[model samples]
Target: MARSAKAVPWFLFAAGGTVIAFILPVMIFITGIAPAIGLFGDALSYETMHAFVGNWLIKLILLGIIVLAAWHAAHRLRVCAHDFGIRADGAVSIVVYGLAAIASAATVVALLMI
Candidate 1:
């Protein structure tokens, strides 16, 4: 059997979808809802969050979430474009995946800067 280069993007797409479905909501709750409800009592405050993100492991997790989410979004958009009668799969894939790559690189730089 011949090797298929499509596996990498597909893997990223699946992993990203999983992360979005599973982790994104909890993140929204922790960063948005929980604080509003005062559940953690300043646990999610700026200082606390800054300190939390300062950890290398936390940074890695954050990076994964961001990169995966970006890739997932890009792949979704590409498919949506095709579904919408856009026959230019090559161009669409290039634009969408390029944006994902840029987003991933930016995320890495941003996380590293932290």
Candidate 2:
């Protein structure tokens, strides 16, 4: 079936944003549970706690949300801007997509460095 032009981006943005909101929180909670629940003679210290949080898996999850949510936020904000007639269509699209792209890039780079 042929999809309408308007439905495409909104579908992607909403799907991505929903997965981020739903699955990612559960993943984060699961990831942290062992540390939070288990206690021992060799219990993790404050520094170790920081390092655990700084691990690659957690970093990746955080980066994913940042990438998805930033775009979602930008798109929503653009729609609101258009609804309010605060800017021309061309300018609004540019501003929204541009910020989303920059946010995505920054998030990926930050994750890579961790």
**Clash totals in order:** 0, 0
Model 1 residue pairs with clashes: none
Q: Please give each candidate's TM-score.
A: 0.91, 0.62
lDDT of 1 by residue, 37-76 (tens): 9997977899989889989999999999999999999999
Which portions of model 2 show Cα errors greater than 4 Å? 1-4, 19-46
Q: Quick one: best lDDT, which candidate?
A: 1
lDDT of 2 by residue, 1-114 (tens): 775576755865896689777876776665566457764423466676567758889887777777777777877887899889786867887888798899889888866775
Local error of candidate 2 at residue 79 (angstroms): 0.9
